[model samples]
Target: MGQQSDGDAAVGSSTEFQIRQSFQNKEEVVLSVKDYSIRQGIEYRVLESDHLKYHRKCKEFDKGCSWLIRISLHARKGTWEVRRYNGPHTCLATSISSDHRQLDYYVICARIYSLVRADAAVTIKVLQEATEANYGFRPSYKKVWMEKQKAIAQIYENWEESYAELPRWMLGVQSTMAGTVTVLKTSPIHLGDQVDESTVYFHRLFWTFLPCIEAFRHCKPLVSIDDTHLYGKYGGTLLLAIVQDGNSNILPIAFALVERENAESWSFFLSNL
Candidate 1:
């Protein structure tokens, strides 16, 4: 029986399985199997799956391929252990496609979660190259882009959750650092034909750190304002207020997030600034 070393389970590492190998849980077993299938350019179909066991066979099992695996939970050991394995697929490659059936967005996201978390701005081309380098196959551009989005969403909270946490985050900042200024605006929540007065939705936010505000007193009198579009699950504009120091170093003093760069939004940000 083969066992994966700690390094073998790390990001960008190769995945392989052997009979009698144990996994922490069913999810781990499934992920390793999927990774192995994708790396070897093969497809598999689940033959049996349940809370206590998992079994899979090659997609070409009926076409003379004798590849299959079975894993079951070892109640005494509190682990999932592979019971049988016939791998290193004997079936011919079905096609020359760049994509594989087992290499879906979810798998890609899991594989690249750490990279995306470390740098959310990493480009899709970079992710594609990384995937190719790791698995010897490059997925479609759209697929890699979608996978990056999912990875980001997983690292950071989803849009709805993030919007809901804005007020709490602002309060946390203010509590931790006194004199911090934060202005959060919310609109009434509307459901179908009725308005839910008790509920509110995030509309806009403006904030300036106490340190930034104090630093401005020592900086040049001139302030530069600019707005940039946000590219995420929810579209918005980020407004920034910056000032130059005596040494010509630019310092950001205030920031705001609004629906768009309109007269009203600009007015709101400027008033807060």
Candidate 2:
């Protein structure tokens, strides 16, 4: 109703009306630089490739320098920069992911820009030329570092104070041996201090010969049993033994001291056996 119809004048009016009714138009979509940058980050400008800065690939070489640069740059991941990596510059689609085997690179590397511009100090470290070469941030980087800190805190608590029970005299020794055992291990001491072996055999046995019999039970036999002396309070050596194949090893089973290791002691030993 409002405008002229030049196309309709050329075509029959009826044909023009039919064409207009039947035709459906398609829309065009164009994503501008600003839109991409906003979605990605300020560093997107530095990360994107420019033909002038990057030369074309060469057939002579299996790979190019740009390819190497692209491969080295890793991605950023995790909560902190702990495990994350912001790699150097490069060409090609060599971006990184949590798993490096998977090279899932973004067409427009928005994430790379987001991480690079985050801290200004990085700008000075990664010059403009290098920043553009490597694109895309690596993921899963930040999560691994936090776990190690937790382990060290649990394993190294106070070590010196835990062993305080040892007495100053012993220094490092933990247990005590009394009576004759103490005399053998240390030196002479006071009267009431404790008479080691003397108390057991002297006071307990009333100074009888019974204690010698007790010592014989623990003694290992010399096997080269000897009886050079015939008399003394106690004498004669016995064999030492251990059970083997249901028979005793030719070692001592016990000791039999005598008034003198004489025929009398041998008689007593045979009688006991």
Candidate 3:
């Protein structure tokens, strides 16, 4: 009875109960709060969300549940701050229902992507169990599978963006290792008028560092060349030149990206080599 009285006092004294938590963004705040709500068996829903602020209320709002939380972006701190929280849930919450968005693809990805990346072989069952343990909910296998694919796509998209900065990256490499780096890019010819000139496209890209070239020269007179298929969004072939040193260490010399494994592509790759 004493503990119940203290709890009632805590809930009644709103001025004394402060929730000054910070979040990186509104999405983070919502996701984090959802997890907290699930773990504590508190049912709530987003009453309002916008660029500037977010408002959430107890799921039993129609039952006169006054539990509410309000968060707003702090301009100076560049973070979302909890501005208000009317505590003490009025209704019982024993389980998380399917109506909850915590199991959504985006949310699941944000929650478990780092774990998935750290252990690529982690199975869907393991992820499902982890989610249940952490957030009091278990997602279906199909949802977990879809969320995993979404996470992998986001990772590869970041890697693809790195390729766009290759020109500047090669420049920096050349600056660091003077006369040791080489980069080449070729495009198709435009045959038509001004508007069609935009159709000209990049065909191939090749890069090599002089250190690898010189290292191979002293290692062995034998050279091994191979090509592999790239499984990125823009599918292509990766051609590589390598040599084995006296100690049997494989040293890579150069690499190139071509459209396909055809004779013309092979020739273009060999010419660069």
Candidate 4:
């Protein structure tokens, strides 16, 4: 009988690699977990669920129990799979109010920021409500907006500081070698032949070291050119010139940054080349 019980336990236990050929509904998964809890002499509750996944926690969640599990629909097999599991509740109380496992705004902010950076048009109001439903408290619209700005700054750094450092950084680039060049043009607004406070700006920066240019003399006659957009507070474009050597190694000959990618900008970049 003891050996039979051990066999039953082994059969019921879940492994990460388990796969099922038959599909099961939410009720079936919950029943299986309920049976498991009964056998173990404990209780659990469904924390969250969607069409594709379910997350569960110990009934003692509000009392600080850390036991939890996550299950999801298997993509290939059309069956339920145990994606995660944590065992052995440690709370002293079996019932309490206010979940300890609930996520705070700081943690929510980090995730919210990531989502917004990936898709700036994501609806924060919808996210706020979703967060409230999932974690039991809603974050205010102002808080979510602040976190979005913080996340953007974290990803791109301080935009004002970046602009201020441009001149000094440009000097450092030109100090490296002769024949290198960097230019800044500010298009100031004019009112009836008088300059105004408003302005539009353009930066025509270019750089090529002596070694790179000299090395290109021995390279093949063919060249490759390309351009890419710069993701910054003030968006712009970058243009590049590259050549190949006898060993087929890529040798970058020149690079430039322009206010926009247009015929005039390309002409200016190529003229400096």
Candidate 5:
């Protein structure tokens, strides 16, 4: 096994490589190479890639550029090491577009994950500006929007996992807060043409905290309900019930997530409210 570096260099920022420099895994090596290629505005062709090794050469290697690199996993050391590397590109830059083929959504996700974590409502235009400032290229609006969604999934749990944990979360909330109300509705799971009676999937959830329910007693008798669409992996509607106090202050008393806004959904939310 080859010797490993004491510390792995940060991806997307480390543009230089040396023989025997190690990475945590194959993914890290590939990300670092892609970042370097994008930064230098040079294109590279992948010669080989697998679980054990990754090899790439400059796109113009045959024309004149001698740039190339080979990274292989050092099983004994539990690290991926660069086994061969030729210096910076000697050929002219081939790409002069506003976007780069190597700068995909995954790469953009890594760069914007911190921003997303700090502010979940961060806009795609802001992300695009950030990317352009850092990489000198403006990715398409669709690409940035897709990457922002990916970043949100990373910051908060993914949609599937969030849905899977709903029942547990509801139970915990009820147990920890006395007088809290939670109603979960599930539908039978379907497996292609057959219905799986043994398994069920989440359909809707209605919840209200003890404080909000108690506060509603002192508020006006009138109640207003509204809903907004959820634009995640699974489409849904978020229903909310609010009441106004004597001072005209509005307070939310109930909330629910349903499939859509319709008579049945509204009836369910109102009946529960």
Candidate 6:
């Protein structure tokens, strides 16, 4: 699809010209994918996704879940992202091509990232060529989303050994324009639950701190300053932080683990995370 001079009426025009009916609901997409997976007997998992992410603003919303197709077909860019939103629930796919030129580029890259399964291994060379052919557009920016994904997997495979099974490593993928963005957050069900120190460390590194940094990755890291007290256990409130990386998916490069969470422990973590 090419760019329309004005974006506001693009959807209406597309429907009038090409689409015969309203876009499918997110639930429908999920059901379709799920049904297909079931029929194929593909071992898979649903990813958290947002109803708002997969489809255009339909003036309404529905529930759904994103999926990782256990079997990946050979695809070029825009192979998946341009498709309907499918989900585990609340997993938001990034919109590519707000402008027509970039649309092809984003559509393919985003789709590629979305399909990555932790259990599968792929080569970077193959992924790169596929993106180029699929999108049919040479990206204006130098982008390598798969490389980022590989880096994240390495971090997880390496660090996860330390944590027997406290926090679970879900999935990591790159987003449009932004490359691969890792999604790792806490699923703590109880207050006094035992967790892995490395998981805790990585949790802070990938999910917590990077938001503000990523917002400004195009710019230099924008640093802010503040002060607080140490109250509980540390004579006062000790400085606690959550870190995430925006420039890349929320995966850690390396870490040093411990038995439990503590001030002295976290203090050392703050230095690296």
Highest TM-score: which candidate? 1
Model 2: per-residue lDDT, tens digit, 1-273?
111122011111101111111111110000122222222221122232332121112121244322111111112221111111122222233323322321112211222333333432333224222323432323232321221112111222112322122123233221332211111022233468665544322100001123334444555542234444422123324311221222343433333333344565455544443
Instruction: Give the worst 10-residue stretch by lDDT in candidate 4.
Output: 1-10
Residue-pair clashes per prediction, in order, are: 0, 23, 0, 0, 0, 32
63-114, model 6: which lDDT tens digit per residue? 3333322212113331223333232323333323322222333233333443
Q: Give lDDT per model, in order.
A: 0.83, 0.25, 0.69, 0.63, 0.85, 0.34
> How would you encode candidate 4's per-residue C-alpha lDDT over 1-273 as one tens digit per residue?
111111111223222223332325554465455434433445667778898887888787777787787878887777777777766556543323332222333434544654665676567787676555544546667766666556556654567766657778778877766655565555666679798766644456766677778888999999888999986568789999999999999988988888889998888778877
Please say which candidate is ahead in lDDT: 5 or 6.
5
lDDT tens digits by residue: candidate 1, 157-244: 6788888888889989999999999999998988899999998888899999989999999999999999899998789999999999
Candidate 5 ranges beyond 4 A from true positions: 1-9, 12-14, 189-196
TM-score of candidate 4 to 2 decimals: 0.44
Tens digits of per-residue lDDT, candidate 3, 54-115, equal 99887787787888889899999999888998876767774547534544665567666766
Point out the higher-scoring one by TM-score: 1 or 6: 1
State model 1's lDDT.
0.83
The TM-scores, one per candidate, come to 0.90, 0.14, 0.69, 0.44, 0.85, 0.24
Clash pairs, model 1 backbone: none
Candidate number that wins on lDDT, 4 or 6: 4
Query: Against the true structure, candidate 4 has what lDDT?
Result: 0.63
Evaluation by lDDT, superior candidate among 3 and 5: 5
Best first by lDDT, ranked:
5, 1, 3, 4, 6, 2
Please write out the lDDT profile of model 5 over residues 133-215, one tens digit for every residue: 87888899999898777766655677888899998899899899999999898999898999998888888889999999889
Candidate 2 Cα deviation (angstroms), residue 129: 83
Residue 207 CA error for candidate 3 (Å)? 1.6
Q: How much does each candidate deviate from the true structure in C-alpha RMSD?
A: 3.8, 32.5, 8.8, 17.2, 4.5, 20.2
Stronger candidate by TM-score (5 vs 6): 5
Error of 6 at 88 (Å): 35
